[model samples]
Target: MPTVTWSRLNEDRRAAVVAAAEAEFAAHGFSQGSLNVIARRAGVAKGSLFQYFADKRDLYAHITDVGSQRVRCYMEDQIRVLDPTRPFFAFLTDLLDVWVAYFAEHPRERSLHAAASFEVDTDTRVSVRAVIHRHYLEVLRPLVRDARGRGDLRPDADTDALLSLLLMILPHLALAPYVRGMDPVLGLDELSPDQPALVVRRYVAVLAAAFAPQPLTTATPGGAQSHG
Candidate 1:
């Protein structure tokens, strides 16, 4: 085994505590989760947790920050190498694939996000929304603009609207498996591993078809100068 430094071990312990707190909150929600239980599960003393985080709310915020960074890093690593000249749908397909893979591997992180959504404070909601929006828009708006400039999307298409649509769709798709258990109408459990990609492809295809620039067509023969 590789030797670890004391600082590295401390960082690992802090991460463990955060992960344990996330799991506890995900299982019981913020109001009911116990810090002592989290510390025990993380194999760190309760005082160590307090040393790292001032309170439950502070720890929860840190967990959310970590989760946000995890998702941002995942998307950045995948999208960084994408060919800018490809059709916008190609990039979207890659995005959907990355999202599916990430959610599959980090179901607990997804659960933590879902649990955090139920917190009662308006300020907390606003802060979380700002963080999410900043991360998404920083990466997504430029891609949307590039697609429009390349004639893959209509020039009139609103980047913010498209981004919002994608944001709405991805989480719904990611959580569909669990949602289907509560309401069979969702039918997400019916999807195989490949189905997420297929579904995203179809959705993007339809959107692109609707929004792609239309070339002007001239009237043929004796027709009165009609245009498409």
Candidate 2:
């Protein structure tokens, strides 16, 4: 067999390392995973891991970056195919569809992310956590702002508040299956990848209705005392 040089390793090996690392992290979380085991699983030496990454945190960050980029690309691709004139709820539905696809296609990455969320390392946790948090904010902030500009959203709607609600709601919906009996009606865990889109679509419709701009109606003369 020809010798494998430091730079001669194919992309397959690199992908293997990432995949193995994701599984390791998902199984053990950040603080508990063993680099030695990871290296062995990746068919590399413990020292070779350092050749590819400075440390465990670096590897974890790289995983986060890769996963985030994949999700961003999926969202962008979906958005590009959408009609810009469509209502904002259509865009939200597309967004959820992309997420459902991602979770189904990359379940291990999702598990890794779920594990990372509870990490105890202040610095590493905060850094990686920020990447995921910022990803959602970066996408939603502009979308919400544009919707408001187009009169698709309520005039008094708080973009930040809406972003926060979406950030909280999407993940909960996405991860409900993994949450252990939290959503019996959804039973996300039991549903296959093909099934999530429909469930998520209905969920987004409810949110869209709640956030949709409503026509102002004149108050009744004897309407209950207004707070403002």
Candidate 3:
């Protein structure tokens, strides 16, 4: 958490400090991130950083918190314009497109998120992971409920389990292009402009198949009727 002195700083100064910290941690993970470099980049004295935060860990935590908020805000903005009446799979494809756009444009924030997700300290990692998971679930729960209600998804499906699979795979879809070795088959080095769209479409196809409504069959004189 930041001190009152941090609040007293001008908005531009605060923004500079946050930007510097994000860049530093994005370039080097928490363990190797340098306060001196951050101070130099932000044009503030190293001691002034201590006045703003208690320690390196505190600053790191605050920066990650800021990044998470930015991610949520970006998603909220996308949600406002997206069509709510679209079918579940169509809506989901658009939702994933938003993820790809956000991560692609904000590489620094993505790196900060990755750092927190893979934090070395067990306590920090768990705490950050909880917040990330909560945000993801909050965004997804409604979509899953709506899909089930609309009979686009199986009513018997476990919401939590379905969300867990989405949490595991969807976010990584955005990273495939940016991260080295993450897209071995896609060969992002020479990727076409439409390659990302192709990736998302294929992934959504698999999800649609996996989550399709279960068939309801009734007995007939000579056959079973499928009400799938």
Candidate number of the best lDDT: 3
Superior candidate under lDDT, 2 versus 3? 3
Q: On a 0 to 100 scale, what is the lDDT of residue 132 in model 1? A: 60
Q: Mind sharing the TM-score for model 2?
A: 0.74
Q: Report the candidate with higher lDDT, 1 versus 2.
A: 2
**RMSD list, candidates in order:** 5.2, 5.7, 2.8
Better of 2 and 3 by TM-score: 3
Per-residue alpha-carbon lDDT of model 2 for 1-228, expressed as tens digits?
A: 112342467889888887777778888886677888888898888888777776667777777777777777777677777754568887778777677666656777667667667677787787677778878787778778888888888777766777888887767655664556646676565766566776777777776666778756555568844332
In model 2, what are the clashing residue pairs, if there are any?
A: none
Better of 1 and 3 by TM-score: 3
- Show where candidate 2 strays beyond 4 Å: 1-13, 118-123, 184-210, 218-228
| Steric collisions counted per model | 0, 0, 0
Candidate 2, poorest ten consecutive residues by summed lDDT: 1-10
Q: In candidate 2, how many Å is residue 31 off?
A: 2.3
Please give, for residues 1-228, the per-residue lDDT of candidate 3 as tens digits. Answer: 789999999999999999998898888876678889999999999999999998776787788778878898888778767865578888878888878878889888778777765578776666556667777788778878888888888777676777888988765765667777666775554567777777888888887777876567777777857564
lDDT of each: 0.70, 0.72, 0.79
